[model samples]
Target: MANLVIASNTKAMKKLDKGTKDKVWAFIEKLSADHTASGLHIEPLNAAVDPRVRTGRVDLHFRAILFKIDDKLGDDPTFIYMGTWPHDEANKLAERSRLRVNPINGVLEGIIGELDGEDDRKKRTVVPDPRGELDRAIKSQPKSYLAERFSLADLTERLGLEPDLAERAYAASDEDTLLDIAANAVGWQGSALLDLATGLHIDTIREKHGFTDSPVDDTLDEDEQILKALEQPASKMQFTFVEDDEELRRVIEGGDFAAWRTFLHPEQRKYVEQNHSGAFRLSGGAGTGKTVVAIHRARSLALSDPTARIVLTTYNKTLAADLKAALLTLDPNAVIADRLGEPGIYVGGIDALGNAALNQAGNIADAAENVLGYRGAELTHNRTSADKVWRDVVQSVSSGLDAKLATPGFLENEYVAVILANKVTTLEQYAKVARPGRGVRLSRPQRIAVWKLVEAYRRQSRMDGSLSFPEILALAAEQLRLRAEANQGFFADHVLVDEAQDLHATHWALLRNLVAEGSNDLFIAEDSHQRIYGQPVVLSRFGIKIVGRARRLTLNYRTTAQNLHFAVSILSGAEYKDLEQGEESTDEYRSARLGPNPRLLECDNAADELDKVADKVREWLGAEVDPATIAVLTRGQTDRTQFVRALGERGVDARALDNNPATVGHVQVLTMHRSKGMEFSRVILAGIDDTHVPSAATLRAVPEEERAEALLRERSLLYVAASRARDELVVTWSGKRSELIHSEAGE
Candidate 1:
């Protein structure tokens, strides 16, 4: 008797149509219970280049290519389901494809084509190196990191890895080396790497791939061995396996990216399960699976202790809702807590946490005033909300001052970044505190004048009984600190922050007090290049230290190769910083997949752009692509509204994405900001006109000296929109295109 294992979702399985998929599902369901050659049309393929390669009839016309492997220790054989195809195509595929263990890394991989050097590629043992280190140390080898350290000949032997992918990965140069040597090496060395560079120093690749963590048990059947590797994804990794019949169905019916939630890239899985002494930061470019790690991190914590008091939070209510949804998707049966510091996982926006804590403090206004260092300060009950509320205060207080110093933007920056950030209540403290990241310096008299504006803004907020979101966070942090000092409040055991780059300093202060300082207190995920809001603040300034515990994810799980290059070029010449105030690295990053170059359509006006958008949408729909997977992102609410109206007139039935479920029947439209933490199969960034992008109103408010910095944020916003596209992207503009848009590298 032999065992049957449905290898987890593959690109091949995803392409099968419904009728064939249903048949394949029925075939596997029967095979799992009874894998007899008679019950199922299973037989050896005489045409296959390798005798072990076989074909099994899924239905009358469809046949699945099954790779048969005998247990290494001589036990029952195992049948692995590769994919389903037409009977004729399945025979052609089995004729050329063979599964073999890489002599260098000892990882099993499937390959097509002839082996160039049959004698040179000697088999290596499955035992890993004793170093027990990550691949980061592999880069010490210098030029052509992997090529210099390991034999490229042995790497391409047995045709395990494509020769071109190996050449590009090991080749030397400033531009081609966009992907980091270590990140790319380990990234591809796993199941994903069987298609790329598969050769590395045996000692390094073995240890890096988790062989050192635990050696493979050869006495067990091959199916059991692979199951162990996949189950222990963090400690030891190999294949993507579907353990049950339901997962097989999920793989067979691919859409909504459900399979991705179950199968993680090994590199991402490492971060999800790694431990650190204090705060740890995992930052990566858009689509590198940072959010994926955040979701799994919550589950890992809760599974370790069901009552761990884990709070998974983000910047806004929308993103928090998304996180909560994703957390539930990861584990639907787990109980979600109703309040902060409760058992199980609690997902919510940081501001919501502040409101809840303040409400629990008996009197919200009293808690806020005390945190402001103005206890007994007259406060009103009205809560009016507004952005940049310092224009009138600056105009009325700063006389004979430089116009740049008196702008509402500059004054607001001083008030939020320095005064409130430092909890300074008096004008003397404000005048003496240092202002970092502020372009223009201020004289003592000028500081005194700015202090008056800050005071007035605070006074106005109090009178209206409205505290800014930052003020709410500051107040919440104060309450947490006071309660912790008395050792009474039940605080979070672990706090995981996603979209960390957009959080204000006060947000970090509250998070710092939410969890006690110990091992694995905080796990942060962010990408500064995707930061669309909130100014950058140093994490250490708020006492959340991440000095030595940080890792950058360099492999992208979304975005095509061509679109990634285009999106990255938009960030050319811009500098970004990490939470520790260190320069962020954007190089050595690589795309996991490739697609057609992003389309740049220039037009006469927005009407013409919308016309072209409708044409593309109609064309994609005609081809049977799911409408729910198509998105049209815009620069503003105005453009979002126009997209919906214009597409409806064109008979596309486009709908704007809101809190409701309008996902299936219509193409979705959304402002770029609303599109964060989301992905689509196809995207059209419509109406990127000059006047709309880097919106004139936004730049008009900034001081002249800091315009460059403001311009960087705008580029980041565009990059964020471009990378949301997973398979294809089309950028359209009217009149003159935004100066921020850069031509593709080759163009």
Candidate 2:
């Protein structure tokens, strides 16, 4: 008797499982005899269960039944069984049982499982019928639309469901049931159902026509096949989206050149053409492409003289990287590297280059000691010092000195002479300069007395060097004077200084040594309208000859017309009274327009103002604007940090521009001073109120005329800030209105 029983009512035989197995076997024998009696041949038993089945070792017992089925069958034979197991577990067990049967039978059964199942007559089944409900749903859909084709994975993603859930929905018995399950699974709506239906219709059509075979013409390309498919109305379904491969290819190629051209501006191109001289500065408006020019200029110089060493250094390393990328693109053969001493193009920041030079000269440690005394040396050794040591030095120098000595007014006169004369390369040389020069030379007693004064000042101020800022200028000037006396020509062929307006008298004296008499290759680019830092150092004092050599680029390409106009109105004072103004003749900036009218937002408090700014950013994003184009300008780093934190809390992408180098894509949030020469798409000038603007009483400490000039510099900074915006400008403040704004508005 078979241990595995096939019964019509499986649930009813639980109480007499052993007896039922015997009864089932008897029934099978009787059926075989009946068939023989009716003049039909009966095949031998295909399979039967073993009676030695045990609970725990049921898998082993089931193996015998499967073997009988496999050995007795001449060809593939069907078998059925009744069991009490979880549906999934039971299916797995049934598969295992079938595998242990005839190997050929097992293989055929696996193939059948892959096909899902067939009707009672064993014909391959089509996709389940929708029955009444699906038929109604299909009728409601437009004739222009069809069912969609999607994999179970695609359905899972679209529906935001687990993979298993989507798979179960797909395996539903009928179209109506599948739709019902999917609707519940995915929270179906009008558009969602339409999308699903479209996928299904495509799938059904593909299956019905057996469209898996490749077309006969093997020589035809994929694009040609796609075009051929499009030609057939049935193949070109209603919802299919197509792309023109040829047009797409052209567009991709065009974008590369466009990006390249944008990065290399007109000034940059001109600079590249006229690349000569070891030291030349490329200074201009921010987007006027100084960095780009520097890159190509370096490349051109490298090509002209392969052995000529070149260094492309900026105030920012990121900018240096950008410059390096531009150079590589211009000359693919150019050997450039990021590290300082690399054989090719060396790119770094100003300080980095300075440090590199100092390191090579073995003077960086000495220079640090001279500028910052014992504490600096300790900090240098430990590498844990705060970065404001220079600022502290400047402050200490200003505080201990006589008030008259502290004035910048003494720089070009008394200061320039002292700094020019004081260079002690060795300890012996320091003894010679201990005395203040009397007529031509000093007596021993007078020298000792002067040395005592110098030593006292050095101890009190905690300075390593005896020379002050003015003394440095004096010493540098004396170097130039002595060089002329000796008839030795200027060391450099040409001299160019960037941010020329910020240079003080001492700076000028040092720079003078680079271009002595008969040096005509002096090119300086200075925008008097953008000197937003330091004391009022006159450009005229450098001599009008230097000013005459400068060529002006007056086109306001960075900002839109409205922003430019507003900035000009604010800064067009007596100093910049004769300045030429116009738009840049470039296509990039030609059609750019202001998006909104510039406004000044005022609040009763700082925290309230911050909340308002956050709210505004959220509103802008909601209006479909990209977060990258917005910027928030502040007076200091403190404001920047606060604003950044507030914006972050409100889920806005905000970054403090402090210490972060500017890139082409970033929305720069910087001080007005830092924003000099740089431009943006949209600018927000924050804290433009009384306490911040016009500053404090420090302007009074400066001479009245100099103070006026300093105020003009502030106006110039405002001009730069306002003109940075190529599209929209926003000015925000708290408390009293900024005097500069009021003055400009009145004008």
Cα-based lDDT for every prediction: 0.71, 0.42
C-alpha RMSD by candidate, in order? 6.7, 25.4
**Would you estimate the TM-scores of all the predictions?**
0.81, 0.48
Q: What residue pairs are clashing in model 1?
A: 178-588, 179-588, 180-588, 188-193
TM-score top scorer: 1
lDDT of 1 at 66: 80
Instruction: Give me the overall lDDT of model 1.
Output: 0.71
Question: Which parts of model 1 have CA positions greater than 4 angstroms off?
Answer: 1-5, 9-15, 19-100, 110-151, 154-238, 241-258, 361-370, 376-382, 388-403, 658-662
